[model samples]
Target chain A: MSPLAALSAAVRLEVVRLATVRSSAVLLALAAAAGAAGAAALCALAERADIGRSGLLEAVTGGSASGLSVVGIAAALAGALVAAGDARHGAERTALVLVPRRGALLTARTVVVAGWSAALAVASLLAAVAVVVLWPQQQLVAASPGPVVLAAPLLGYVGLVVLHGVAGLALTALLRSAVAAVSLVVAWPLVLEPLLGSVLPPSRWGAVLEGLLPAAAASRLVAAPPVAAGTPWLVGSAVAGGALLAAVSALVLLAAVRGARRDA
Target chain B: MIEALALSKRHGSRPALDDVSFTVPDGVLAALVGPAGAGKSTVLRLAVGLDRGSGAVLFDGEPYSRLPRPAHAVGVVLDPRALHPGRTARGHLRSLAAGAGVPRRRVDEVLEQAGVTGARRSRPQHFRRGAALRLAVAGALLGHPRTLLLDDPLTDLDDDSRAWLLDLLRVHADGGGSVLITASRAADVLAVADELVVLRRGRLAARGPASDLVAGLKAGVLVRASDPGLLAGAILRWGGDVEPCDDGALVVTGLDMAAVGEVARAEGVAVHELSRRTADLDAALLSLELPETELLPGANPGAVPGASAVPA
Candidate 1:
């Protein structure tokens, strides 16, 4: 078979394997719950406290658009399990045997897992939309987003989710342990990246580092809520964050090639 | 054909395999036999490029990694237990089948061929060891590769399953495929191999036709008499090592039937039964160019091949 055909088959197999696992079902349920809770909280706050349009968007979008909270964490977990599951279950031995070329095998896994994570983000977005239409949060907002205006952040949220997941998968491959990979991903925006973002001066160094943070990019895509509407660095952080996501993807592909040669 | 040349594998500071070289010719099945730690499994792993090792393993004279579709050239079953527990037998084969660009229907075909029936929809964890082995073997056959690298494929097989698998392997070989199996039991697998590669202490002990290795294996005759003790004593005095059996017969090692009869005739001892007994697989291996006296005595405990029953 040609390399392209082999790669296509591998991706198909990986996608099916990930979808059939019991954990995927549980993950979907958890994502749904997170989306529902985020929407409900946003709707309640919009009606009671009068937060406005961006607040309503953030509420319905959940922290997913910002690359923080449930959606991003769920996406990261999904990515980590794609790799960590194989190692933990000893399926790596079988997988390597089947594909033989470690680089191809890793590449297939990255594409499939990242694709699934992005799809999950879309699902969460759809759930958020249902809540917006059902709960009537328009009265609290002065102005709502047009379809064109809304599409940018929706696409951005999907990109952020993919980045979070791909990063998780790559880190899992690097560490060869799911727990370590997931911990690093989970703790990043929750503690480390945000802490660093806050402590560092709002200068070039901070801008560079913030761009590297997926959650910051995702947060910028959501444009933060009315809670912190006056934050001045939104556009800079979003641009940097998106570029950082692309950079990490290249790094993952390179690492996969280098790692397979050494370890396979 | 599967050819592994001067392959060397190391784990930490210890060498798992050293200059291991052999070939499973096309249209033939070969067995790698040794006690535990003999590196039988290592050879299969290195052959399929599952483990990093020095040297080259070629499938049909091309490196497994170089094959456009390695699965089509080589199908490997490294560990039966290594199968994903949550995946049904069909699910497991489906994923691998896709990677090989095989039609989805081929999964059902392999499951049928491997003797895995209705259990295809159930998780492998619920299957018996034999069932799981068949599922694993079915997965290996998914690509219809010309070469199969199996790691202890008969580990948990029963007598009927063993015969069935032997037939399947023979058919694979007959159809012009190469079968390279890592095995510990000499009796079961030795009978199936087109050739035998004996490993001892992670080194090549011997490699030749199975028929040639079994040549020096027959050690003595089993004789049942009216007075087995008396006959045993006479045989012992005549330089034969005798072990009394539960059936009141003597298993005479080191003496042929003609000599045994002569001794019986001289002693006026009447023999009820006389038959020759060939050495078993382990004895055949040990006595290959070695003295016949080292037959491991009576009843080699823990004698199962491919198991970790190494001599201390």
Candidate 2:
């Protein structure tokens, strides 16, 4: 078979691997549930304020939402499960036998994981939209932005989710342990990065240093215009976000290919 | 044909495999026999490109890494645990089938052939070691490759499964495919193997046709006579060595069964039993384990057709 055809077959195989595994389905359900709960809490807070819930729902759909944190976390875990789980189960050897060229297998896995993350992000957004449009207030339905207006932000949200998932995959492949990768993915963003950002003084140099952190740059990438203006520490521009995303995507593919080649 | 050219591997400061080279021609069933930790598994791993080593393995003429689709060229079963515990038997086969780009129906075919069709939906955690091995074998056959590289696959199998698997391997070789299996003993593969490669301490001990190697092993005779003392003296006078057993039977070396009978009759001894005792092939093979120089000189050049290859 031609190399391109071989790679294409490998991609299909990876799709089957993800689809047939029950853990992937469970992860998707958990991400959806977390997204719904977060969206609901934000809606309650918006309703309590005098301005009402539509603005919050608009922001939730527009990529500046906070409740989707769990979705990203779930996506990351899903990636780890695929990479580290295969190694633990001895499926890695079988996969290499099927596709001897490590690069082709890595490419196929990355493409499938990115596609899975995008589908998951889209599902979460749709669920949030359904909740808003069906609410008794009905203002969100009337005030919803046109597709043209929502396209970039929606794409941004999908990109963020994909990056998070790929990062988990890359780290797990490099470390060769699911537990180690999981701890770092969770602790680094929620605890370590925030603590580091706070330790730095409120100065230009400190902002630049803080902005170099992945989560910081990721947050700035999709922060709403008003939120970006108000938050002093969110120093990363859209360019920084793009750079971070590219770096993460490249890191995942490289780590997977290199690690696979080095080991079995 | 599969050719392993001077394969060598080192783990830290210890040598796991040292310059082991052999070939399994088409239509041959070959066994790589050695004691535990003699690098039988390492050779298979290197053959399939699961590990990098000092030498090269060629399937027909192409290395495993260069094969466009390796599964379609060589089937491998390095470890039974290679199957995912969570996936059902059929699910695992289906995954491999998808990767090999074979028809999904081929999964059912291999499952049936491997005799695990009844447990198709059962996960591996629920399977016995024998059942899981059958599943692994099924997965290996998914691509119907021309050559098979099986690493100690017979270890955990039951008698019935072992018989069935041996037959399957023999049939594959008979049908013009090649099979290379690894075992810690000769008896396991002697029934079907056309070629045998023996390893000792990660180095080549012997490599030749199975028949020639087995023929070169020492053979003795067992005798039980009413006049045991008379028979022993007569056998000793005839230049035969005798060792008495607890059961009053005498094990005579350097004499064929017919010769022992002739001596007993000439001495007017009553012979209750006279039987040929074949040398323990496994023990004889182990006895052949010596440094390459020492091994060759001690071997029987006449008994073994390829004396050089048999360390004889």
Which structure among the candidates has the greatest DockQ? 1
Residues B228-290, model 1: lDDT tens digits: 878888888999888787889888877888989888888889988899876677754543323
CAPRI-style class, candidate 2:
acceptable
- DockQ result, candidate 1: 0.49
Residue-level lDDT for A190 in candidate 1: 76
Q: How high is each candidate's TM-score? A: 0.83, 0.86
Ten-residue region with minimum lDDT total, candidate 1 chain A: A224-233
DockQ for each model: 0.49, 0.48
After best superposition, candidate 2 residue A60: deviation in angstroms? 4.5
Fnat of candidate 1:
0.61
Q: How much of the real interface does each model capture, measured as fnat? A: 0.61, 0.58
Off by over 4 Å in 1: A136-142, A194-214, A224-238, A250-258, A261-264, B221-252, B256-278, B283-312
